[model samples]
Target: MTASLVSEPLDIASIRADFPILQKILPEGQPLVYLDNAATAQKPRAVIDKLVEVFEGYNANANRAAHTLAAMIDLELDAARSKVAALLNARSTDEVIFTPGTTAGLNMLAWGWARKFLKPGDELVISLMEHHANFVPWQQAALATGATLKFFPLTPDGRLDLDRLSETITPQTRLVALTAMSNVLGTINPIAAIAARVREVGAVFVVDGAQSVPHGPVDVQNPDIDFLVFSAHKIYGPTGVGVLYGKESRLRELEPSIFGGNMIRSVRVDGSEWADLPARFEAGTPAIAEAIALGTAIDYVQAIGLDRIAAHERMLTERAYAGLSEIDGLRILGPAVAHRGAILAFTVEGVHPRDLGELLDQQRGIAIRVGHHCAMPLHESLGLASSARASFAVYNTRDEADALVNGVARAVKSLRRKRS
Candidate 1:
C-alpha cells in the first residue's frame, strides 16, 4: 500500500503484532524489552515472509540471465529500487545503488569520490557526532589524498554547532560528511540547512542516514543532497543490504569503488568501461533476498506512516527522558526531547554502563546498548568512557520506556551498593 492510502491513526497494539519477535519471552523468563533500535530493528513478519518467498519461489541472479527465475529476480530488484527512490524522494531510481550496508556505502564514497577528487589543499569536513563508519573512512581518504580533515564541533548539548559552518565548510572544502541523526546522542541535524550550505560552498554533501531514515521522512531532492546512505536492518528489514543515493551528476563524477562481474560495460586487456548509473556501483551478486525484503519493510512503514511512527517514538523518548531525569545521578545525553529522535543515552555517576546493561538484561530482559556505541569521539567529548543507550521504535511502548528507566534506576542502586 502507498503512503496516500494510509490515513488511519497508528494502532499501537496492532502495529506491535506485525513484529513476531516482540512477542517472544527470553530464557530468563522475562519478556524481551528491546530498546537497542539504534543498532538494528526487529524485522516485521511482512519482511520475513518476503525473504522466505524470494528464496523459496525464485532465487536467481538478478540482471544477469534471461531465464524465468532470473527475470522474476530482476523485476523484484527493480521494484525494490523504485520503493527506495520514492522513500527518499530521489529524482530517479538510477540514483539509488544497493550495497552491502551503510558502512560499504560510506566507504564507496570516501574511496571513489574523496580519494579521487581531493587534493593537498582541499578539506573534508565531518562532525564530532559522526559514527565511526562516517568518521574513519573520511580520515583514511584525507590521509591518502593529503587533504585536510576538519570536524564540525558540537554544542554543549550535543547538537551540531551550525554557527561554525562558515569556518568548517570553507571554499576549500571538497566534501562534508556527517550523520543525519547521531547514533549515540540522537541529535537530529538540520540536513536541509547543511545541504544548502554545502551547495553554496560547491562541496559534496553526504549524509549517513542509518539513524535518521528509520525514524522519519527524508527527501533527497528538497535541499539537493549529493549523497545519502542507510541500512535495511535498521528499518525492520533483513541485514546485509543497504542503499546509497547519489545525485546523477555527483554519481557520474565518481569511479566505481568495487570492481567485478555486473559493474562492467565492456572489459579489455588494457582498460574497461563501466556500466550505467546503479549497476556501475553494484559490482557483484548482492544480497538478493535481503534487498527484496527491504522493499517489503518500506511498505510496512509507509503503510503505518512515518509521521505517526515519529510521533509515537517522540512520546516514548519524552517518557523515557522524564523518568530517567528523576534519577539523582543519571545524566541524559544530547538535547531536550523536542530536538532529538527516540534515543536516550546516559551515564550514571557511580555505575558503569556495562554493569547497568548486564543487570537490565539478566534481571528484566531489557536489551539496551552499552559502551562507546561505536562513537568513542562523541563519548570522549562528553568526558565519558561509555554510556548506556535505550532507543525506541514503532514497536516500543511507554511501558517499555518505563521499564528501561526503572531497570536502570534499580541497576544503578544495586551496582552502587555493591561498590560500597
Candidate 2:
C-alpha cells in the first residue's frame, strides 16, 4: 500500500487489520501465537502490498535508467533512504546505504575497514555477547589486516563488564564493533558509555543495531555511533533489504567494498574513482521494491508510536516473566529484571528445548524459538546448549503469555509422568 489503510487516523486496531497474516490459523485448530518475532517480524499488508505495487506497477533497476520505470524505481529508493535517515536522525539521506541485510552491512564495514584503516598489531574490540554476524566479520578482518581482535567479557548478571571494557580500549584500538543489544539475552547495552570509552582510544565505534532498532527508539546521533546496521525484516518490514548508516566524516575515510556500475564516477583503462558517500557503498542494482516496502513499514510504525509499542511490550514481558518464574524447574536467562525489552530466554530442567518447542507447536500452536538464538557465547556462559525463547511484539497479548506458560507446564508434567 502506498498509504496506510486506517479509516480513523492512528488507530492500532485499524492498523493491525492491515496486516493480513495476523489472522491465520495453525494446525492444532488454535489461533497462531507467533513468538519468534526476534528472528523476523511478520510484515503488515501495507508493506506487502507496496512490494507488489512496485514490482507489478513499475519494476526497474535503480540509478542507471533513462526510462520512466527506472526513474520511478529510483524515486522510490530515494524516498526509502530519506525515511531511514529520518528514523536515525541522520544529517542527510545520502548517509544511508541499502544492502542485502545486516550481515551484508557488517561485511561491507569489515571489508572497507580491513582494507583501509587496519594495521598489524592494531586492536579491534567486541563483546563476548555478539551474534556470529558481528563476531565472524571482525575475525576475518583481523586475519586479513594482521590486527588483534579483543573481546570484552560479560558480567554475571548479563551486562557488559564496564571496567574490563575501559581496560580493553587502548591507543592500538582502531575499531570497536559490538551489538547495541544482545539478540539472545535481550539486554539493552549502554551505548553512550561504550561510545565514550571508544572515543578515548581514538577508535570508531560501530553498532550492530539489528535487534535494537526493531524494539525501541534509536537515535544514531544520540548514541554517537560512527556506523550502524540493521535489517528491515526484523523491524516489521520485508526481507532482502537492510540499511547501513555511517557518519559522513567516517564514510569519507572508508574505501568502497564492491566496485561496479553505480559506485563509480569514471573508470579509466587501469583504475577507477569511486562515487561519493552512500553510492560508493551501494554498488549495483538495488532492491527497489523491498526498500519501498520498508518505507511503508516505517510509516506503519510511526502511526502506532514506538513509545507506546515499547511500553505495551514491556507490560507483556513482565507478565510472562512472572508466569514463567513461578513455575518449578525452570530458570530464566539474561537479567530477570523488569522494564527490560521484549525478549525472554529460559531453560527447563530435564527437557530438550527442541522437544519443548515441538510439543508447544503440536499441542497448543504456540510459536517459541529454541536454540542458541545465534548468541552462542551467551548460551555457553549460562552453561546451556539451547534454550526456549518466547519473544513479544505489538500484536502479542497477556492471554498469549498465559497460554505459553500453561503449555510449558503441561509439557513438564507429561515428561515427569513418563519418568515416573
| Candidate 2 worst ten-residue window by lDDT | 1-10
Model 1 lDDT at residue 264: 97
lDDT by residue (tens digit), candidate 2, 1-420? 222332223344565577687688876688788889889998888898899999889998888869999889888888988999988899898789899999999998899865578989899988878998998889899988889999877778787788787678888888999888787877878889999888888899999999888877789888688999999999899999999999999888877888889899989999999887789998888777888899998888877766667767777788888888887898887776552578888898888889889889888888899999887876887888899998987777778888888888898788767767
Q: Flag clash pairs in model 1.
A: none
Give candidate 1's root-mean-square deviation (CA, Å): 1.9
Q: Give the per-residue lDDT of model 1 (tens digit) for 43-91.
A: 8999999999999999999899989999999999999999999999999
lDDT score of residue 265 within candidate 1: 94
Name the candidate that leads on lDDT: 1
Candidate 1 at residue 138, lDDT? 98
Shift in Å, residue 370, candidate 1: 0.5
Top-TM-score candidate index: 1
